[model samples]
Structures are given as structure tokens and as C-alpha cells.
Target: MNHGHDLNRRDFLKISSLFLAGSAAISSQVGQALSSTNTAFAKDDREEVVHSFCEHCFWRCGIAAHVRNGKIYKITGSEHHPLSNGKLCPRGTGGIGQIYDPDRLAHPIIRERKGGKSSLRKASWDEAITYTAEKLYQIKEKYGPEAIAMLHHGYGYTFFKEMFKAFGVNKFAKPSYDFCCGPRLQGYTMTYGHGTGTPEGIDMMNSKYLLFFGTHYGENMHNTAVQEISEGIRRGLKIVVFDPRFSTLAGKAEKWLPIKPGTDIAMMQALMNVLISEELYDKKFVAENTVGFDELWAEIQHMTPEKAATITDIPADEIREIARTFASYAPAAAVHPGRRTQWYADGTQRVRAIAILNALTGNYKMPGGVVKYEKFKLPKPEAHPHPHFKKDVWSKYPFFVQTKPENSITSHEVVQQTLEKEVRAWFVYGVNVPETITLGRKTAIEAMQKLDFMVAVDTLPMEVTGYADIVLPECTYLERYDDLDGGRPYRTPFVSLRQPVVEPMFDSKPGNEIARMMAEKLELHGVFEDSVETYLDKRLNKVGSSLEEVKKTGVLVGEPTNLYRKPGEKLTFKTPSGKIELASAQLKSAGFDAVPKYIKHPEPPQGYYRILTGRKPMLTFGRTANNRFLNELPTARENEIWVNPRIAQKHALSHGEYVHLKNQAGIVSEFPIKVKVTERIREDSVYMVHGYGHYYKKLKWAYKKGASHNQLISKADIDQSTGAVGFQNNFVTFIKEA
Candidate 1:
């Protein structure tokens, strides 16, 4: 019951402030305290600490791996790292679970078909690498390098990316782009000419009022964001949340508006109308720093609160009042452009509306408003020359992020192309393909089954690995050296390191080593250094830091960058017009709406409710689905479908009953999910955590734990402009347990 040295809420708050102080002594004290209490460490065992970043999620918070007798016994937040400061999420401490998971892929495996029956057989690293490279070359020789595509999710994919590029195979994709960050990134790029980087650019700690549209910060638990939000709450910052379900974030809000799903743009337009009509908008800021104001006004002039109230289901007076309060906060208030925004087909426009709202309130770069965080200016090392990519753009979408040379297509496009046989080979790295949202689980599996050659590089034997022709066992983050993480943007810009805390277990190898082996087998000359450590040292040397220096604290910090704009400063944006685009010229040129428009999405069919999916605070979908340490908590054990009282009664579902969900396409769930009948959800929608209901037998802890959200997504609405897949259109009906 003690749960070791548990930090109470008050104690956590006290230490949370110390994170900003960047005190090494405080970090040491904290780390020692946690390590001393860990029963797994023996008093006689020699102990050492190694600094690295977490791989549980993309936020990549720094971690301190406490090693006893050459084995990591505990993990704690690194104080020297800017992102985590000294605090870590549940997932960070759960790295040990991943590293020691019994289900982990321990060696290289190749699927052999004998007498039309296929089975995986363990193979030596050289045999596996050689076979994989040969097949990839054959695919390239027959179909072209473009025919070989990769779907990657983790930081480990960097080496493979370079390897693929050296081989002239440029088609790459990340599933996160299709279902998560893509819409918001493209939306902000279209309006502000840049994407909102991780930790987001919100100055929450200094803000008076924060407006959120279904952004569950508490549940999502991005380290810096959560820390700042908690600090902001202590400073008496007011919050307003718009979500159909009363999310953990909504529970902390001064106002929680249960806005109708798929009508966010309408509500945003209504707020703009009120701000413009009531003359509450920052007129001077809009006139001086932004273009297409007239065009934006014209589009939203008739979108009054009264009209939006009917569409969004929030009272007209309430909408106006919220808008007025938001405006009254002036440069301190901002409407947060929420993450995982690919809900409706108009997702990009939805975020654009958020951008326009924030701009109208004159909160572009204010201390308590929206600001652009800077990244550590780590210079890149020279790269080996390779053949130019045959194609610059593979996505059919017009406005995919093109600020940099994008050799990849969208993940959904990859699925479509694979089904079409245009993509003959696939390299899946650290992503569970079937669970990762693309067109759907069925379509993803179909595409994988149709592939001529498929190689999966992962730590665990996830479902995707079963479909692979070759499986390369990748060591867990605690046992790997990845490329330096300098891309994360923050107030005090810092570059974090990911170094091995222990030797890799079993026959599994680090991603860098695997990539180098593959590159060598393919005869790709000079693509990689003699060793991963050498490669990292060379890159770190460019920034006047070495691997040895960074290994001490796991991060190299830079001076804090100015995040706010000066008063009366001339503003220039990266947009074609050189100003904040209230109406995007590029979108218009691409034959799309210049300004965001609220298009009506299809309503749920009779006898069915829309399925809303989110994450549990302790788990991040697939990454933590099989993590035993994190899953030990009561809340993390399994996911349940949250049904409203009205819907539960209509379906004769009790609070503790179990039911299977059938989608609109009549695809029933494989496992029955526990029903949580509560008022937290709307009668028209049911809520469930994603990344559950694993059917893979190898995932012992996660198998048949809950219903899979991805499996129910039989319908997909692709955003034409950005190629992001919108899946909120799918509806589900309950089927009582047999």
C-alpha cells in the first residue's frame, strides 16, 4: 500500500518548482531518495546512474537510469533536462517494464513457409540483415526505390531513415501524421507559417485565462505542458474547456462546455463574430500585423452566436459570455489549438479557426498568450552524398508540410499505395501497424499481407511483427544509443541525449547498430560511422559538446530565448504575404477555402452513438499497453467504454456489465469491453481509451484487455488538403455479452 516513496500532491508541487531552478544537487537528492527506497537494489551492489531521455512517448523527457550491478533497477526524471525538469510521467518510470517485458522480441526472426504453412524461426543477426537487404534491393530493382516505403514512430528510426535515403528509397511515413499532429501542424503552418512544436508554444504559467477545445492535458501528460498547467493552476489561472465528455482537463476548468462534436469550427466562428461585432477584438493589432482581415470578417459576419448555438448546442448567451470573458483577458488569453485534431474532415480548418481566434485576441507572441518556443541551435554534421529522390512529393494532398524536403508520403497514402501494389516493400520501425490509425486495422492488415517483403524492427512482438517477413529485435530505449534529440522546441532550449544504461539483453541490438548492419549489407558506403558512439560524438562536436559531456547530465542547455514580441515591433510572417494570414492565399490557390468554414458532418445513425477515443493518464495507447509497471495501477489495468446513463438504460447496459461494440460497417469487436455507465459522457457519444483490446497472444498482459478503438474505425474521412485521416465519423452500437 505504501507504493514505495510516494510523493504527496503538496510534496510534488514543492519539487515541481525546483525543476525550473535547474539544480543538479536537487536532482541528485531526488534520484538518491527514489533509488534508496527501491527494494530491488541491494545494499552491496555497485550502483551507477546514467542519464537519458524516455521513449514512452514523443515528448522525450529526460530520465536517470539507476543501475545496480550493470542492470537498471530504477528510472527517475533528470533534473538537468529542461523538459522534465525533475518530474516524470508514469510512463517514464515504466521503462523498466518495457526493457524486461517477457514478450519482447529477443532475436532476429524470419518467417519460413514450408508446405504452405508459415512459421517464424530464429536466425542470426547477419543472416537476417543480409536477407532483409537483399529483398529490399530486389524490390527496388524491380519496382524502383519509391516502391520501398517505411512507417516509423520512434526516435530510433533516424538511423534507418538515413540508411533508406542512402539507398535512394525515399518513401517514408509516420502514423502520427495521419491521425494525430498532422492537421494541427498543417493548419498552423497555413495560418502562422509554422507548426506549433511540442510542449506547444502556450505561455500557460503567465496566462490569466486559457481556452481549450478538447485538449486533455492532464490525461495526455506531456511533461512540460502538465508541469506548466499545474503551476498555472496554483497561480489561479482560469480555464475554459470545450469537450462533449467531462475530461480530466475539463474537471479543472472554471467552465466546461459540452459542445457538440464536429461543430468546433462553428463555435470558433461564433466567437469571432462576437469579438468582431462587439468590437472586443484587438482592432489595431489586426489592422497592422495581419492580412485578409476583411476576408475573414466576411466569412464569419453571418456566423452569429445565435446561429452557432443551434449548430453547436451551447446556448447563444453562454457562447457570447465565454467570448466576452476570453476577450476581456486581452493579450493574456488564447484558444489552444488542441492536438490529435484529426476528428472531422475539416480538421485543418478547425485549427485554422483556432489560430484566427487567437490572432483576433492579439495573442500571437505575448508573455501570457501564444508564443513561439525556440529549439536548441545544434548544427548538423555533414552527410554522405546519395542519389536524388525520383519524386519530391508523393502525397496527393496539396498543403502537406513542405517547409523542409519531405521525402515521405502520408501513412494513409502508404496504405492505399501498398494495396495498389505501388509500394511493394515496407519497413515498419517501432510502430504497431494494425493498432496505429491509418485507413483502419483491417485495411492496414490487408496492406501488410499484400506486401512482397515486410520487415518489422521493434522491441516487443507486437501484432505487426507477426505479419512481417523478417523481424529485427530492437533493444529497449534503456539499452540503446539514438540520435541526439535537438528538434524539441522549448523556452530554455536544450538538446537531450539517449544513451544506453545497460548492455542490450539477449540477441536484440540497438537501432543504430541494426541500421549500420543493414547499410553495410546493402553496400551503402560512408553512410554511417564505424560505431554509433562515434557518429553521436561527431554530431555533438558541431555544437561544441561531446558525448562524454552530455552523458553526465543527459542534456546540453542553451540560454533562454525571448518568447514574446516587443511592443510596436514590425511583424513579418513566413506566409507568402509576409503577414499573419487571416485568409490563406495558398489554400485559395490550391482550390480550397481561403478561410476556415464550418461544414456540417454526418450525424450518427439511428440506434448508434458516435465513438470518442482518448488515452488514459497512465498509458499512451500502444507504447504502454503492455507495460506491466504502469498497468499495475487500478486505472491503467484495462479500458472501459464510458456510456451515458440514458444510452446505458436504452441498451440495458449496467455499470459493470460487458459488451461488444459493432461499427457501422457491421465489424464487431473481438473482445467484450467493460461498460462504465456514467454521466461523464454524452448520450449521443460513448468514450473509450485507445490502444487496447490486443489480440496478439505474445502480448501477455495486454491481450484481450479491452476493446480496440482502431478496429471500430471502419469509416475514414481524409482531409483533401493535408491528407490527414478523420475518423470521428464512425459510429458504434452495443452488443451485450453472450
Candidate 2:
């Protein structure tokens, strides 16, 4: 090679810069052109379009796809959508990558042997289903249906349970409760005695104050409420954020209280102490609309500000100021209820304290604040009975999830205990377990090992399928029929259709069709198994709409509607006492302290830090971990340890330092992260992202992105009463490695 072929460093640099600028300009133009292309699939530039929803992050926002042929160009949130408001966060806009993922599982596979971690053998659907049903029969014959446990998470529970019932396994639990959104139900139930309404869109557009207890509404925006919150902030709403980390929401808030982790109860109680002591509470509203003010006041009086402030590490004066600010805002001030409650051991109680604040302020069911969650009533699919299992095995606990669905213990605890052979098989669908569950590297193999058989049904051969004995390819949300809960109705209510943009790549089928097919094969086929046409007709006709109608319009308007707040209307709290409970009667009856108290949790050793990790608003755990488009958006294991700089400096720590996080579980992993050491974090605590650190080498990009947070955690410290692991109660201490 000629020496001159290697251009001088300066000349090479100049040429490279020119090339980069040209590429960037070209890319920008492509993005602009792509936006205008109605049919992205056109070979001659035909604007091919497909109507679908973005499943990238599980908010499942509906979208009309632009596809010309087989190639998917780009995606945008359904602006016409009331829920999505024609807007999408970064992930939703980048949803096209999922449609054409090169790594997408393209065929049915059967794990031949029971042991050896069930590698994919590449089987045809005929062979796969035949083997699966046969094993289902064998498992039933050998171990009874109750011996089987189904851990199903994600949406579309209705269509996936056919096999669980057909196989006669009643131990069906969705990881949603364990992995997320479970704590909301628990707190709501404990307070209101009923499952809560869906995540109510905080009417941020009209609110004057927003208190965030680790609530990242803007970061996780999808539902209309998130949009409302953004609008409110734009209009200068006083935002107060309380978290251990200086989160994106916290950065935006007018005030950020870096409270100690796992002691939110103390902070909330301290705020209550302020509200009561200052007499900022709405006495008139409490007297007219509530029932147990005297008792609640008396109980909180015992939780003095000094005690709560001491535990939460929030200055008592600041606590008082926050309380007064919140109380003064009246119905215009609201505390945001975040999704994904399955965090610490005290997760439910923490949420309960926050929800009760609404009641205390007489903000219950009001405008721009604690408003009711209104969902458009859609026609139900035909009520198909889960055919009586050949045998019915029920949980002795008579599981009580405080809120709707996702009681953590009711799902994984059931699965793990049953797999230790307490349960024989698992028929699961609508989720990818290995990704959704914590400590997935271990759980994925262990869960599959103890079962007599395992079947997973999903749109892709997700990580969970690697361990599945039988894999059923299910369609994406766009190619399936399902129920939707959080979208605009007066914006218009209509059944949205997810027609196939392309053929079912391989043996893939929609859950509805899969359920029907399984029903027919299992000998349970009858009125329910007749045909998709008949079932849709039977079910949809009741709601004054039909499948065919939805297919045609993509959605149906709920009609002229009005859900409003009548000013000066009496507020009604949804508790047994019909008032906010400073001292929960349910807590008292459960043989626990009535007041929300901060109890000391198990402490980690001096050398290790207690790592509290959580879901990224950009990517739901492991869901978008594989989508390069979404993964490249932001926060791919930028292992940020939210520590007090005071603590970091003492340990000779610096930002961007690489340190090993070693836990008692013997998990030793190193991360080179930007130490977000700031005053916003507790001196003793740290936090990072979960769902990184993929053990599967095949996951190419996701492997070792960050430490496996679950590895550092010992699930041994579960809340006995609820059986959910107290993720917060387990503690650790930080040590700086030289």
C-alpha cells in the first residue's frame, strides 16, 4: 500500500468531518422525507401504510403504520388518538424497528429433551402443538392440573388462558404484579377497599401544583394524563419531586427533596404532620365529605414531624413548606400516582400514604387534581367460560391484590414455589418472562427446569422462548384483536383494528386465533370454538359494535360524552370511613401499626451499597432492550449511582469512575458510570437501572450493558403479609474500589 494512501492525520480528519456532515444532512433529509411518505413500503416510493399500535413500551399507543411493501420505514404516534394525543415519546416514534428486526424468531421450535436447558430444535407448528398438547395431557395425568402454574404478564390475558384452563392449571399469575403496577392496586385497595381506576391522567393542563413521589410522568408519558401533566408544567404549575435520585421529573420540578430511599412513608407522614399542625387542611370539606377526621387527626398527631423528619432525612421546615404549598393549592394540587409499584418491600404502604394525601387535602375526585379515571366502555368479547379444568386447584391464600391485577406474590411466588415441583407445568402467554422477571438469568432456566412441560406464546421468540419446551408464534398488537383501556373516547371511542401489515412471518398467529385453535385441539371446541367470525359477532354485538365494524373503521367513537368536575361540589373519599385515613383501619386490622410508619429494613454490609433499580420510561424492562431503535434512544445502562457527593468524596469517588458493585448475594459486577453524586440523593443510598446485564450471549447488544441489579438483591426479604419481595427493605453499603 502506498504511504500516501494513508492521508496525513489533518487531511484525513478534514475529509472525515466533511463526510460526517454530509451523512448527517442526508439523514436529516431522509427523516423529513420519511415523515411525509404515506406508504413507506413503495418500491417506486409507494407510501405503504399499516394501522397498528406501538408495543415497544406496553403503553400500547395506537398508530397508523406507513408501510409500502415488506420494509417498514418509520412510525409516529397516532396523533388522532385521545390517549396518545397524536404524540409519542422517543420509543413509540421508533417502533418500526420491531417490525423488521433481523433477529426476530421466524419459526416454531420445540425443545426435544426435558433437561439441558431446552434449546430450540426448530420444529413445525404441527409437531410443536402436538408435542405440547401431548405433554399437557401427560402432565395432567401425572401431576394433576393444579400442579401447573401459569405466570402470564402483559396485555391480552383473555386469549392466552385457554391453554392454562385446558391443561387444568389454576395457578395463573401475571408478572405485572411483581414487576410493576402491583403496588398501586395494593395501596388503592387498602385505602379505598376496591381496585383502583386505571392510571388517571393527571389533568396537568389545569393543575396548579404537582407532587411527585418518584413519579416520572413526563418521562413515561403515553396516556392522556401525561400530556396533561406536561401542559400543566408549561403553564407554571408548582412541581415538587421527592425521590432518592435526581430524576428527569425531579430536574423539572420547582423543588426536589432527595429523601432517603425506602422511607417515603416517613416523608408522607411528616407532610401530614405539617398539614395538620398548620391547620392547612380543608376542615369544611373533611367535615362535610369525610367520616373519620377526628380519629385520623389523632393518629397522625402521634407521628410527630421531628420523628418523620429524622427518619426521612427531609428537613422538618422543608416538609412543612411542601405540605402547606400542597394544601393551599386545594383541588388544583394533586399527588401523582406512578405506575410500577412493585419496588420496595413497603411499596404498597408507600403508595397508600401518597393516595391518602389526596383525601386529606379534600382533593378527591376533583378538577386538575385527584380526578376519577374514566375509561370508555367498549363492547365485551363473547363471555367464554374458561372451560372447567379437568381439575381445579386454587391458591389457599385466596389471593387479595390491593389493586386491580398484578399482586406480586400472587404471580411469581406462585410460579417459583410451584416449580420447586410444587407445580407440574406452566402454560403462559402474552409476555416474555425471562425479560420481565427480575433475576431473569436464573429464573428463566429454573422456571423451565421444574416443569413437566412449558409453552410460551408471543409475537416473537423472545428470551423466554429459549427456555420454552414449546414455542407458539403470536402476532404483534397490529395483527391481533384485543382490548384497549387507556385512550381518548370523546376524542372518539371506536374499536381499533391491528390488521397484519405483512403475512404472519412464519407459524405466528394472533392470540385470539391461537386460543380458538387450542380450544378445538383440546376437545373443548363448541360454541366458543366455532369461528372467529361467530365469537366476535357474539361478543361485539353486545357493545353495539362488531369485529367487522372495528376492522373497517380501525376504531369507533364512544359518542358525545362529558366527564366533568362540578366546582364547589362535596368531595367524597373512597375509604371505608369515607374519609382519608391518616391511620388506616385495614392496617390496624392486619395486625400492623395503624399509622404509616417507617420501619428499619435489613441493612447491607458496609462494603456494598443498597441498589434500588427501576424501569426506564424509554424502554420497559427487556421489552425494548432488543429494539436497536428504542435502545439507541437514551439510557442504555448509563449506570448512574445516585449518591451524595459528600459520601462520594469521602470514598475518593469521582464522576465517571468505574466501580464494582458487590452484594451479599456474591454478585460482583463493575460499571464505569457517571457518578451523579449530588445533594439530591441520600448520603447512604444509591440507585441504578434494572433489566440490563443480559447473561444470554445471543442478545448481542444488551449483554453487560450494566450490572444485573437483581443479582445484587436477595428476594428472601419478602413482605410476609403480601408475599411480595420487599425490594426496598434489603440494604447495602457503598465502598470505593481503588
Candidate 3:
């Protein structure tokens, strides 16, 4: 808001260029090291290569693990696989680290009591399973089947979700949707008639323009999308980014707008206004392929660039110019839907605005825009209906309930219910809620303490494990087999295999085996009745392939098809109107605005700044926060708060000086972190990479190393349509150390 800030902006651009070059050099060296084949162990020593999918962070890249004398030696990208294309990101490169980490939970353990001082003792798998089954039955008989709830993640989550349902448990808290990508998926599904599958279907190869709003592909390290965007850049694709901080991708962008946080909708609305006012939209495409265009135009007529400039803090001239550039590019340009759509209460409508922009430019199913790929069908076991429960998504968060058939419960809504003692038991599998969820660590601990019973299943001993009544040690991805990843949005949708490169260490068991064991104990049939390999074989049969062929090739391929929709193909949508709902009658009927309108986000109080968090290339958000190889990378070792130089001076804080942070709720980070005084971030905000400040004492490499952004925020503003927990609305100020 001040002219003096312009000087800081110019300085930031120059400084960021140098920072990126240094970072790139470091990344290249690390990548080369990881990809290099470790030939110290001779191939003749009972060595072999196994094809599997990397579960390091859920990109599901095909990986080849080399085993020597019954031990994994190295991991590399599968050369023939479609997703990786003989390349693996930094996180994927550390696959061996995850599998061989010394701190992994190697045996089942049970806590005698609740609270922090409760002692844990090692137990056999039989004892653990029997205890869990008996307790589950007892709780079900007393409190009803709805008393059991689950919070889980990882590739095997599908089976566990069904297992709970088969056991007649109706409550669940799977957080992937509410915490990460629910709003984005819901918005796209409402507008385009289908959800944009992960590793999005964007055809970046032929695109002329790439528009990003707080989404940085390079930083996120989505393997295929990074490759496509790099190729697009080489072919002269113009990149525009709108973010509060100068992120890794922002350094490479042709145009970077330092947008005010929580104001993306205002900027998008202004773009639509300019396109509609100057007749820059595709008239032919609109008339034939879309519905509700007239209503959208009428609503946007009052939202001029000048009005938007006041809310977004971006120049009016720049807004008009960006709109023109996008229109001229026609269907080749796209507004990329971001993955982390949990920023504000109005997140769903914000994504709807971007969908409207795409519709106006006729980008759906275009060569360089959004495309829909065919999904590989798998056979599901027959399910019997269970009694509906009162405390469910349909009762509490009906507006956000997904229309498409899905079984997992809305996570945030369940967490809220946990506080009120609505559930009696909880099962946590392969997720770290203490470090990753919104609110704060203290709140999570309180909720866990209140549960009648809690069980955790993971390879690593995490904070959640410390609170569990029983802890089941699950084998790592490399030590066991998992379900196939039905490939990406590419023309040829390939299915990749996950086979064990080595046997499970200690007494750990594969997730599927654990699920099957429980199913047998509960007398639940059909699902999990067969071995994981047998199920995979049956599923592959649907696509005219077999487990044998998949193991040989690592991936089974389908025939390629055109990326764009044919001209004569009938345009259809799954919405109420059977067309693109640009004006969104669904929203209007739900007691919400039909069109996205600018709402002023709360500003930080005097002497405080908004806390903003994002991903780093080497760190994958709490999953690998303790990975030794990744932690060794300079950028991923520990997080430093990025503060503007002027703000640093104002607080008498020099670079590398340690300080603690306190939020509006008086919640403080336990550890102190060093300051990074730079001009690459806005003065009103301080930036930190997520996935640090591990409180689990056993995670030696990550414990008390850096400040956790999650711990500093205590507010929860859930999105109306998705129940996404919004933490970006939190404000904090630094506390100087003695």
C-alpha cells in the first residue's frame, strides 16, 4: 500500500534470481547422486530388480528397487513407466531412506493407560489383533457400530475404508479431502461434470500460457506435471503467477503478481469482467458448448478492474492486460486448479470462479487445457446397507457432501464431533494428525485423550502413535505389495504394479494382511477375503492384463487417444442442468451466492503478520520430515521464517537470530527458529515451509528442529461446501528470545 514497498519489490526480483540459481545447482547435484546406480554391491551376490510404486508422497511414481543379498541397495525410476519417464523427484529418490530408517516401528506395542506418562510394552501380533478385535466388538455391542471412527491415509486406504463399512462402522475421518484437495475437486466436478483426477489432466505440452494462483508445480514436485511444464516452457509458454511469496516456480515466471493473501477470487472476477466487457471471449464455443453465460456476464458487469484492484492489491492495468493475453491465447491457455485449496471459508466458490474463466475461453477438453481421461474400472465386492447414523456428513455438512458415490466421511466434521465425544473409538493409519491437522497440537492431543480407544498403524513411530492404546507396526511400501495405481490423465492410461522388493523387517506386516486379519476376526466377508496379490490379479483382468505381465513390464499400457474433444461430440455435464453451471444454480439453491463475490479477509493486527506456509521440493509435508537423506539437503534440514528486511529491522531482528512466534490464541511454538531476512516476501506476511517441528521424541532427526506453522495457529474456518480447515486466516507476531 506504500510507494516505498516498490523498492523492496525490485530488490526481491534481483535477489530471488540468484537464490533460485543456487537452489537449482544444489538440486541437480542431489538428483544426480540419487539416480546414480550404486554398483559397490556386485550383481552376482543374489541381486535382483523389483518393480514397485513409490509411496513416499502419493504421486505414485513407478520405481525399480535393487536388492542385494536380501537388502535393498538403491531405488531408481522405472525407465518404461509413463509417469516418471526414467526420472524421480527428490522425495522419490529417498525411497530407500524411508524403507530402511532405523526409527521405524518394528513390532506391535500396547500402552497400559492413557495420558503422556503411560508406558508401552512390546506385544506379539496375535495379542495385538485379538485385543483390538475383542475391544471393537465390546464397544460395538455397547455403543453401536457408529461409535467406531477411522483417520487414515496411504495407498491401502481404500481397503481399510471398506473394512470399516463391512464391520458396520459408519463414522470415519479421512482427511485428504477436507485438509487438502476437496474444494478443488468439488468445484471442477460441479462445473465439468467430473472430478479432475490427481496428477491433473492438463495438456501442458501444447499450451501457450500457464496461469497459476498460489500453485507452484516445481516446488510441489509432481513428477509428470513438472516434466510437461518444463517442456511447455522450452516451447515458449508464457507463465504468470499470483502469490504473496516468491516461490520456486515464481522465479521462473514471465509475470509475477504479488497478490494480497485470500484475494484470488477478486482478481479472477476482474479478469472475467474484462473478457466479457471487451467481447474477448469465445462466442462460438460459448453458444454451443456452455449454458448460463448470460447470467454470469450480467453478474460480472459490476466487478470492474478498478474495483478489483482495491481488493486484490494488484494494478488495474495489469488485470486488464492479463485478461487480454489469456483471451488471445484461446483454448491453449488454462487456469491451473491448485491442490491445497484449504485457505478460506469461501474456497469452493473461489475455484468456481476459475472454472468460469476456463469455460469462457472454451478450454474444456482442449489440446492445451483441461482434459478428461478414462478411468480403469475395478470390481467392487457387494456391500450390505447399514443403519444410518445421526452424526454424519449428511446431517451436519450436507452442503459439502459429494454427489458422486464415495464412502469416506468428511474429516473436519468428524474431528469436530470427536471433541464432543460423539465417537467411542478411533483408528489412525499412516497419517500424522498431530503435526498436519489445523487448530494446534494441543487440541489434537486433547481430542485423542477423550476417545475411549485409539489404534495407530504406521512404519514410523509418530506423535499419534504415542497416544494410541495399541500400536500396530506396518511394513514399508518397499517391504510389501499394494494395490495398483490406475495411471494418470495421459492418453494411454497405464496401470503400475507394487511388488515387495524385500520381506518385512522385524515383526511388521503388510497393511492388506492386517486388514484381512481383522476382517477374519470380525467375521466380515467378501472384501479382504483373498490375498492382496490375488486381488490385484483379478483387478488387472478387467483391463485385459495380468499380474504376471505387470510384474514383467512394471506397467500395463492402454491405447493412446486424442487429447482434445472432437468437434461433433455432444457436450454433456453431470450437474443439475446437464451443462456447465457457470451461474451455479446449485449454490443459489443451497443458500449461497450464485457467483463468486469479493469478501474482505481479516487483516493482521498492528505489529503482527499473517502466517503463510507452502511445500519445499525435498520435504513432503510431515511424511518425510525425518528422512535422513532429505533432511541433509540444506533447504530441507530445518525451516527458517522468511521475513522482509525492513520488518526484520523494525523488530531489531538480524538474519540467523532465533525467535519464537505467538498467535492470536496465545499458542506458541515450543522451539525457536532462525530468521531469514529477505525481500522475496510481502511485509504483511511471513513465510515458512510446512513439515517441520516434529514433537515426537523418537524421531531423532526431526524433533524440536524447527518451528511448526501448524502449532502457531488455532483458528478453524471450514469451507461451506467441503468442510476444509482453513488456517491461513491466523495471525501471529514474533517473540524475541532472551
Best by TM-score: 1
Q: What is the lDDT of residue 308 in candidate 1?
A: 99
lDDT by residue (1-738, candidate 2, tens digit) is 111112211111111111111334434433543454444234345666555566665556667666653445666666545556567776676665554444445456665534432234566666776677677777777876666666765566665564455544556676666535656765666665544444453556778998888776655555565666668778878889888777777877899887776677777777777787788877776667655456656767766667877777788778877888888887788777777665666676667777777767876656666655544575544444455643322433222454333222366566567557777777777565644555333454555556666777765445566556676767555445554432323324444545555444334566777666666666665525455555655556677777666554355556533334577765455567765565677767877656555666665567555676665666665556666676675565444666677778877788766666655555455343346667766666787766665544444556556655655554544444454544654454444556
TM-score of each: 0.94, 0.85, 0.91
> Candidate 3 clashing pairs?
none
Find the 10 residues in a row with the least total lDDT in model 3.
Answer: 7-16
Model 1 off-target regions past 4 Å?
Answer: 1-44, 405-407
Model 1 per-residue lDDT tens digits across residues 577-604: 8888999988998899999999998989
Q: Least lDDT summed over 10 consecutive residues: which range in candidate 2? A: 10-19
Query: lDDT score of model 1?
Result: 0.84
Model 2 spans > 4 angstroms off? 1-45, 114-119, 193-196, 386-399, 402-409, 430-435, 438-447, 459-462, 483-495, 527-538, 559-587, 633-654, 670-680, 730-738
For all predictions, the C-alpha RMSD in Å is 8.9, 9.1, 8.8
lDDT of 3 by residue, 593-674 (tens): 7777768889998898999888888888657877888888888888999999999999999999989888877777788888
Candidate 3: TM-score?
0.91
